[model samples]
Each structure stands twice: as structure tokens, then as C-alpha cells.
Target chain A: MIARNDRLSGFRARLTGAGLVVLVSASALLSTPGSLEGAQAAQEAPDGMALYEAGCASCHGSDGRGAAADRIAFDDPLPDLTDCSFASREPDADWIIVSKAGGPVRGFSDVMPAFAEAFDDDQLQAIMDHIRTFCTDRAWPRGELNLPRPLFTEKAYPEDEWVWTASANAEGPGAIVNELLYEKRFGSRNQVEIALPFGFAEDSSTPASSDGGPASDWGVGLGDIEIGYKRALLHNLRTIFSFGTEVKLPTGDSERGIGSAEFQIEPFLALGQILPGDAFVHLQAGGGLLARGHRESHGTAEHDEDVREAFFHAVLGRTFTSGEFGRSWSPMVEVLASTHLADGAQPQWDLVPQMQVTLNTRQHVMLNVGVRVPLTDADVRSTQFLVYFLWDWFDGGLFDGW
Target chain B: MAGRWGRGPFLPCALGVVAVGIVAAGAAESGAVTGRIVVAEGQVRFAGEPPAGAEIDMSADAYCRDRHDETLMDRPVRVGADGGLADVLVRIVNAPAASASSPAPEAEALLDQEDCLYTPRAVAVRAGQPLVIRNSDATLHNVRVVPDSNPGFNLGQPIQGIQSTRSFETPEIGIQVRCDIHGWMTASIHVLEHEFFDVTGEDGAFTLPTLPPGDYEIEAWHPTLGTVSERVSVAAGETPSLTLEFSSG
Candidate 1:
């Protein structure tokens, strides 16, 4: 037992020299039940749990689980602090920034008020330490390791999201390709995804119609559908590695230049690493093989049934938030390479530059737009405009939380 | 030996016999009492009606559910009919540090996992003392400890009769131990720097006997309710009984 007194705390509203910033209101003080009693060791750092009780326990609860709705004045859903899967991933630095600058600094609800007037950094750090204790287990990976997703290179983190991507040729016969991808995450490290592609392209062989202009020379059809699974093999604070395999089914109308009719299998290893200064890199290498039975069964003489291909994709990018946290903008560049196993097959290469930006307050719904330029075989492959609308459905609804 | 802060029927002639009983209780594990009584004892209780706890859902583990004859209600504020509180920790916090601090006790503290629940919901053990954990259930169970001041450990026990041992050098209160497979299984371990501490049982009473004669501070703590502290003076052979009451608005 230690002696307690009403000694002045080192944390004060006057630290800013502009009088009290007024973060915690008088009503909040009244609603909370604890008296901020100063302890015996005023000269030393205050206990983390004790500070948490004085400053945060009103709404965050003593157990760090959110307080019951009836106890608080507002209705915004609070996060469950005891859930390690989400809590352990949030680094202390982000929380410190949010606490000092207020909720709007992180594009969060204004119900979370700033504490710049009431608590100093040391005091806030003490409170954060107590919050960390709520989640006892350490197996869940930290969010700092999850990096930005690239157009071609999938990051190694398991996700629950949906993405709709459309790519149109810039210089060739009018063509547009679109794909809808759905990903579901299960347990801690596993995810399954399905992708459906459909597109329209101009056909050069359209015959003229009687008593009318040439028949519309455009064809629309579905493309090869793909389903895949990914499992995180290893992860740490700075890096993550995963292994995945995808199977493509020959579901498209091959005669309309829409897809490869040959059934294919692709297996790949993906890695994501965090570099200094908010920069990151993603690497993916995979090999593709055709099902001989499906390829040989087709009576087409234009295709070779005994061919294999390998591909590699790499992306480098950095993320920047607008004025602390209004919006997150990530600018990325990717290098794509592909080669056939047949003799004297020139490797194909492309360069893509893109920008991804969050479109909502929750930062779950995002949009990325980019241009794909051919490096090798430029004369044969036309440049394309690519864009995708992504929704991290795991966080919330796509349209809500704006 | 039966000193109290509140009104209770007493027998003056039974004091000598009750003194011996208190000494044996103070010895704890198998050992003789080490010091004479500079008696300090108390009862911790809620001032009025005690708060209720949520009914624990144990449907995940069949073995645990079958072991209990009726539905089990967790008692966060375990109170007897007379308002006595259980699981409260009372200690002499201001005892002279030099003489109060002792080396780790040789006796082992037992924390058993039986019926998918921790045997004693709360306990106070001396720092650096060995803590023996045993899994008595035949099915899968695990012992998980996470302490901010000390290293954390997790052990998986798939079969019965599995025993794991651990010890903490730094003293920390309310170090949580839980089982991930069974979310309802949990226990609280209070590691103390000194030996002058006791946890209240169902009767909401605790005895910190044999404290040296002096003016001292005593503190009572609970997980849900906050804490209470008071100043007391203890003299040789004189029992000082105090009552600490917790109340909610």
C-alpha cells in the first residue's frame, strides 16, 4: 500500500501555452467513476495500469474490452481491445499519433477525442502499455508487416477483400478486359479466392451487311476463370512469406480471342518485405503448365500441346497519408516477365506504373489506376490503361463508414 | 484471535485455542510457524448487495460440461450471506522492506487444470517460488501465462497427467493465465515481493499474522472492484481486525 495525494500531475493542459485544449469534456469526467489519485512515486514514471485507469478506463473499460453502450454518451461502435488478432497488429506509434492529434487525424470517428491537453507523451505511453496487456497471446502477426497490394504481384498477407479490375488497350483494336475477384480469409493464415474475367474486343473479320453499314465488328465473351488458395508460411514484424497455387479453367469462348482454352495450373511463392522510410517491396515468381489431356483433345492445329511457360512479377512502392490520415496514397511500379519453354522463345516484358488511394474514411474501399507499357515485343503488344476498385470487405461495408 | 471491526458474537475463553489455529493457517504449506503474532487480520466485503457475474458457457468442451452436475455461475464478486467477499487480496504493503523481503520459499505452489478450469481462481505467491502446473483432464488442455514484468510461456497438454513448471523472478500483480482452446478457463496469479499477503476465501476474511510491531499500511485489491488501503498500528500479541468495504453507485 502506498500513500496517495492530490499532487499535480506532470501532464497538463498548459503544456501548449495556449490554455487548455479541452480534449476531455466536463461531462466525460462526470460519466467516468474513478478519481485520478496521485500515487507515492510521483517522482518516478507512473504505473501503466494506474494511468490507464485514470485516463482511459471510462470508455475503454478496465478489462480493455469496450465499455457497454449504455455507459457512454455516443453510439459509435468501439473496437474490442481484448481481441489479439486486431489489437496486437496496431503498432504503438500509430496509436500515439491518433491519441495526440485526435480521431480525425486517423480518419476515425470524432468521438475519440485528443488528449494533448491532459496527458504528456510519457503518460500516454504508460496507458498504451496497459492496453497491450489485454491481448495476451503473441502469435498474431503485426499489421506493419502487411504491405500494399500490387496489380500483378499479390502480397503475402491473407485478406478478405473484393477487387474489380478493368484494362483497355490504348493503341490496338478497341478492347477492354474486366475481372471480378473475391477473396475469403479463414483461421489466421489461410485465404481462398475466385476470379471471373469477361471482356469485349473488336473482331477484324466482320462481314458487311446487306443494305446497311458493316456489321458491328465487336465481340463480347467470358474469359478463363481462376480459383486459388494461399497460406502464409512465415511472418515477422518486418516481412511475410506465402505459398499459393491457382487453377485456371477453360471456360471462355476461345474462337472470339477471349481466352486460352487449354486448362492451366500455376503455383507461386510470394514475399513481402518492409524497407526503411515507409517503403515496401513485393516479389512473386510462378510457373504455368497446361493439362495435356485438354490441350491434345482439341483439334486445333494453330496451338502447340507440349508447351510450358514461366512468369515473374515484382513491385516496389511507398505509401503516404494525406495530412497525417485523411487519405492513404501509394505509388507503385511493377516489372512483369514471361517466357515459354519452347526453343527460341523470346521473353516478354512489361512495365506498369500505378497509384492506389483510399476513397473512404475507413480506408477499406480503394481505387488504383495505372498504365501498362510493353518493354519487350512492343511492336506486338499494345499499351493498356488499367484500373481496379478494391473493397476490404473484412472491415465493413463498401459504401458505409464514409 | 477473533478480533473484528464489525459486531459479531465472541467467546472470550476460546481466544487461546483460536490463536493456535490462526498460527497453523499462517504457516501455509507443510511447515511450522516462523514468527510470533504481531496480529493483523481483516475481512473484505461489499457494503451492500454484491454484483453478479455472467454465466460461463462451457459447451465447447464436453468433458468439462459433464463434470459439473449443474450450471456453473462465475462469481466475480463471490459474497457470502453476511456480505463477505472472496478472492480479495490483502497485504501489509508498508512493512519494513529490509526484514519483510525473504528469499523464494522452498514449498511449491500448485496450480492445477482440472475439469477444464483453473483450480484456485486467484492466488498470491512469493516471487522466484516454483509454480507447478498439472493437467488432470484426459483431453487436450494448455497452460498459458502472459506477464508484462516477466517472460511469458504457453504449454500444450494433449493427454492427462502432464506437468509443467515455471517461476517468475520479478513480482507482478494480476498476471493472467488462460487456455486458448477453452476461452472460459482463466486464473489470476499475484506475485508478491514479500511474504505478508493473503487471499480471502469464501468467508471474505484474511490473516497476515506475525507482522512486526510498528505503524504499517495495509491494502486490499480485487479484480473487478478497485482497491482500498488504510493505516494501522500493530503491537505484539494484540490482534488488529479491520473491515474494508467496497460499494458501487
Candidate 2:
């Protein structure tokens, strides 16, 4: 009987020990936050209340009661932090460390990010200084830590001017073209330009058109309105996106002039890099999709409506600011090129070069004169020249008296 | 001549061995420090009338919130000054090897947010034991922990009236906890691997349980009052009581 009892007892002891091991293993797995027992150490220390308000209130709400239950659609009710039984039993330092770092310890979201970078030791100490106010049973002695205000620098706007410009180009509807242009500055970085060009064709054999003209049997004058917007994307980068419509205003013959209004949208991104000695260089490139409805005989030519040609454009310019005649001015040379891919069999290209002189600081003005030359042998002999004037509306006073 | 030579070296060697033995024994005696941590007063004090809340954070940030470098925030205790439970955390910092655990510790650190306040304002645990943080209130709590001298972690226990458990793997200096909803509620946590520590009860009495026989550097960490440390010694299977005074000194 003794021998049999001993065997049974040994078996029972083994089973019990195994059961205990399983329970402990399970419990440890549920409790451990990995190899770093930092949470445990934090549980040992305590933090202050004021510091908690400054850092944790932005997201966790001001009271320990929790955020508005309706806002986040929480699945459960949040507990209030004032319970004495709960408060008195908590470890001292655990919450302090968690507050400084963030709320990942308790499986909460990282909305309350770590403030180690923003707050220094002294500043963090001051925030902690505020936390001591929450302790009813304890007293907090204020320490020595002071904060100073920062300084700000003011900026003055530059002066501007109005400029008149004229240009001639040989790539449109007529042999010669005249354009009157005006531009104005509304603010430090914004400007508006308007131009009206009239073309008179000698032979009326050109394919393209400018603005305002009569209708001819062989070649006719077409008009175009161009609106543009210039926005600074960065310190040295500016983009210009423009959209315009081509309207064949009635003059004499309706058959040769542009039939209806054709729409066009162009977005250009450019970068200007300032070089040494008050000099700068700018480069811009962009693509535009043009659509035009073909006209037959004073009626809707729907069948002729097709995706015209893709147009590619590029502009390069260099600016010079110092001289004897101008102050705070830049005289720049500009070159622009465009290629059309509408008729797949043969493509037509236009090359333009212009010179511009800009003066004034706040009332800035730019005067430009250029010519457009076609490089294709398609018997399209047309040219144009344009002059424009620009003025600043928001000029003078503190804006320009830098 | 043979007898004289043999006796000369043997006598001196024996004496030298005896002296070394005595020194080792004395060294062991000086390395043992044991003591107890208890509430200094009868119970936690209340400045005004205790509110009609479910739980209260008696510590600086309620629940005796603990933090090494972060802010101190508190939760309102539900029980007025008349409540019975006061959470307190006791810790051991920078102790001698003889006072710490061997390889890993066998104790546990419990962080419970009951009645919106941290139960046991402060606590201490072995280096390898699990630290359990549970939300026992009826409300929702997203426990945010800010730690010092350690990597911080945050967790949200969305369950209503359910317990949420979390553990720390590394031993950090100290940490603090807060509810996203209730900013008034706050608590503290500390991680260590020593055997000598205690948390003051509501009646101001703390007992260091199951401490091995050795000398330890024990500290009483309070959120508002700061920390107090003392050297103590303990014998095998003996319980000792320690008193801490948080005065102007």
C-alpha cells in the first residue's frame, strides 16, 4: 500500500507543478511589454499635474475623466482620474515617463506624440512645476527656471513701374503685326498683362491669325485673347498658367476669319536661379493641348472637329541688373520655341527672341519687343510686332517705401 | 634544520588564511540592509470636502502619479477625504548587487486604474516580472504613459468595466499615466529589480513583502513631496517596519 501510494503522490505532484508553470507562463505573456521593463520603472516614480495639462490636454482632454465619448465613438465609458482609492494606490513615476514619451504603453494611439524635441530640460521642468498643483496631500516647491520671448524682423516691399512694349513676329496670319500691351503689379509677387494685336495680311495666304482683322479670300486675320496667372511655388520657382479664347470678330468677309471661339489652356512651370553680381537665369518648359472645330460654309462642321496638335514650349532668359541708366533694374534677353504636332505628316515650329528692360522696385515695369519666325517651308508667310504698357495698382506708401 | 624550515612557512600561511576568512565574514555583515515602508500618518489627507466621485487621484497627479522627467498631472478621486484606500508607490533605486535579485526577479508590479485613480499610487517590481495595468472603472480610458530615460509607449483600453493588461520589458527610471478623456486623472509607475520596497496604504502603513536577506537602498517616492531613501538590512524570514517623514527637511 505504501509503495502504491508513493507512485500516485509523485504523479499528482508532477501534474500540479506543470499546471502552475502553465499559469505562470500565460500570466507573464499577458503582462510583459517585451524585454524593456521601462514601464515598471516608471510605475515606481511619479509626475506632476501642471506638466500633464500642458502636454497631454491638447489631445487627451483637460480632465482625467477622458475625451468626449460622443466625439470618437468610443466603445466603452472612460474612467475619472480623481478616485482616491485608485490614485493613492498608483506608483509614483510610471505616469511621468509615459507623459514625456507618449501613450504607447497602454495600447493607446500615438496622437499624443513625444515632446522630447520641443521641450528642453528647464522647460520640461516648468511644465512639471505646473503639475504639482494637483496634489492635495503633498506640497510642491517652485524651482528656478525662466523663459524669454523671441524677436521678429520686419520686411519692406519693393518699388514697381508701368512699362509699354511692342513686338513683331512672322508666324501668324499676316506679314506684320502690331500689339499694344499693359501690365500692372497688385502685390509683391503678383502681376497682370493684357495685349491687343492687329494683323494686316498682304497676300492673305498665311494659315494662323492674330487679334482683330478683316476677312480675305486667300488669307484672313484672326484674333486671340490671352489671360495669364503667375504664382510663386518656392523662393526661386514660379509657375504661369494661362487660358485664352480665339474669337474671329466680324470685319468684312466671314468665310476667311476664324469662325467660332476656340479654347486653349496652358500651364507653364519655371525656375529662376539668382547668380553672383545681381544676375539671374530662368528656364521654363510646358506642354499644351489645343482643340479647334473646323468650319466648312457658315454652318457647324462637327465632323471636322478633331484633337488638333500637341504643342511643346520652352523659354530661356538671362537678367542683368547693374548699369548707369537704371537702379534696381534688370534688362533681360528672352528666347522661346514651340513645335506643333497636329498634322502628323509634317510638324511646324516657331522660334521667338525678345529683349526686356525692367525698372523700379515696388512699381516694377517690364518693356518687351520680339519677333516670331516660322521654321517650316509650308508657304505660311506671316509676322507680328507688339508693344505693351503695365502699371502697379498697389504701389507707394509703406509697401514701396522700403 | 628540517623541522624549523617546515614550521616557518606553514605557521605564517595558516595565520594569513585565518585573517582573510575573518575579513570576508565582516564584509558580508556590512552589506545587509533591511527596513519597512508604511504610511507616516493614519491616512491620506484631504484639503477640501471629498467630492462624490467614484475614484480619486490622491497623489500629485492622483494615484500618487510617478514621473522622472515628464509632467505631473492628477485625477479627481471619487471618494472624498473619507475614502478608505490611498494608493502609494515605494521603490529601490541604485542598490548594491547583494540587495537586488539573482538573474531575474520573481515579483510583480500591478498598475490598476480604479475609480479614475491609480490604485497603489506607487509600486516596485523585479526586473523580469510582469507589470499589469488594468482599468476597473465603468468609464473608458486611453492610458497614456510618458516615460523617462526609456522608450515610451501608449495604449488605449476601450473596454468599459473590463481590465486591460500591459507589461514592460525594460527597467526604466520612472513613468506617468493619464486618461485622454479625463485630464484630471493621472498616475505614476517605476521599474526595478530589487527586493526592498513598499507602498503606503490609506492608513499610512506599508509592508515590504518577501524580501531576501540583504542590505538594500529603499526610497519612498511621492509625486508632490519628491523622494526619500534609507539604507536598511533584513534577515532571512524576518519582517521589519520603516517610518518615513516628509517634512521641510
Model 1 interface Cα RMSD in Å: 18.0
Candidate 1, superposed: residue stretches over 4 Å from native:
A1-51, A68-76, A88-94, A104-107, A119-133, A208-215, A293-302, B1-249
Q: DockQ of candidate 1?
A: 0.01
DockQ of 2: 0.02
> Taking the tens digit of each residue's C-alpha lDDT, what string does model 2 give over A1-402?
101111111000001122223322322322323211332233223343444554544344565555564433224444344432223222222234334454332223354434444344554555443333233322111110000000000001111233333333345433333333344434333445443433433444434445556544343454344444444322311111222222222222223332123444444443333334544444443333335543222123433454332222333344443442223333344333333333332433444455554334322233445544444432543333443344433233323322
Fraction of the reference Cα-Cα interface contacts (below 8 Å) that each candidate reproduces: 0.00, 0.04
Per-candidate interface DockQ score: 0.01, 0.02
Report the C-alpha displacement of residue A132, candidate 1, in angstroms: 4.2
Instruction: Report the C-alpha lDDT of model 2 over B190-225, residue by residue, as the tens digit.
Output: 666565555554443444445566676666666655
Candidate 1 lDDT, A92-141, residue by residue in tens: 66777676655655567555655554467887777776676677554555
* Model 1 vs. true fold: TM: 0.52
Q: For each candidate, what TM-score against the reference?
A: 0.52, 0.34
